[model samples]
Target chain A: MSAVVILTPAIVAGWPTIVAAVAGAASALGLVVKQSVKQDIDIAQQTQATEQTVEVELAKSEVVAQNLAKEKEIVVTKGDIELSVSRDERGRCKVCAKGKGKTKAELKQIAEQFAQKMAQCFVYNRVATELKNKGFQTVNEEVMEDQSIRINVRRWVD
Target chain B: MAQHDVEIVISKTGEVKVHIKGVKGKGCLEYAKWLSKIVGSVREQKLTSEYYEPEVKSKIDLHQQLNDE
Candidate 1:
């Protein structure tokens, strides 16, 4: 046990990274990666059949054009549910999900799920990179009691 | 050697919850930044008592370590 502090999240990633995050988020949500920006949405009416769309524009984003393996845009769709993740003109990543047979509330839940997973993947990658740079040796890693990740690292400062 | 543990769970609806433990200081922020890049924008972050400790620096350049962010 060393020090712990909860931080105020600052959004500073470009579109490419956001695309990766979208893929991660999609995978977490059990959405299959069908194609890039082209999904087959087959919403069913039994689930209330209402469609909703949510788009969040990153305000303090600086898009980096570097070619990273995770930079490609990822599109996922399952059944009538469809999702597309891409960089906006301003380079902020955007996520959209639509289902025809599901209620608006259901679709909203799916969208929010995607958003959270995306955030989680992004944070996990960023933290790992920094720890390695700081020379913290990883002793153990695992899923913890509260659905969070516990990473053990040690380094000698003296 | 310290243990770096990351627990990633997707809820029934695909919402993800991440808990990072065992590291300290500003170094934790780097992890947070990297994950935000991988996942999406961060919605919330809580630094426990471990984050206040001093960082243990090895030979790796900060740039190389933080580039993932």
Candidate 2:
């Protein structure tokens, strides 16, 4: 090996790209996308009771460029839990988790997990696309036990 | 021709660990720089012993020949 680099990914992309990552994240986490009405009903039913809601925001990041309409958000459901991924007025990505009969800590954990998954998916997609564009071919790809993604790629440089 | 290999590990928290292999000397730095630009801000970087090893002259010559062609 010649060098090792440690980097922290910044999720700064347009709304479309952010949505793509959200979709990928949802798929990876086995969450199903719910329609707008279903999402509203789920959130309403949860709010009616003593359900907890937790919001986690991406750090030092912004989803800029695309003009996202007001009240536009992507909602996914996994069992009784509902996760809403949206961009706030400041253009920062936010993940809100709400579930009935769940504690604040539980909701917070869920939200944080979803946020991390989304960020990972975003980085993977961006990096893989860029690598392929630069003429690199994937040699191997796998997910580790810790949920981290490992990708090995090679290119012939002449 | 020289084969350049890169191993990228993206943690669950979105932190990236990149290991560049089969590239010696300054060429490896170029790959590191390129990856940093694509990924995000670099938190840390380290150069290994292979980075200090002399580059293969034939590889450079082959690259030059390819460019000339």
Judging by lDDT against the true structure, name the best candidate. Answer: 2
Q: What is the DockQ of each candidate?
A: 0.13, 0.71
Per-prediction TM-score to the true structure, in the order listed: 0.57, 0.87
Q: For residues A71-102, write the lDDT of model 2, one tens digit per residue.
A: 55788899999898887888888998988889
Residue lDDT tens for model 1, B1-69: 556554444332223445566656776677667655544566667777878766774566555355654
TM-score of 2: 0.87
Interface root-mean-square deviation (Å) of every model: 6.3, 0.7
Off by over 4 Å in 1: A37-62, A65-73, B1-69
Evaluated on chain B only, candidate 1 has a TM-score of: 0.68
Fnat measured on candidate 2: 0.95
Deviating ranges (above 4 Å) for candidate 2:
A36-50, A69-71, B55-69
Determine which window of 10 residues in candidate 1 chain A has minimal summed lDDT: A37-46
Model 2 scores a C-alpha lDDT of 0.87
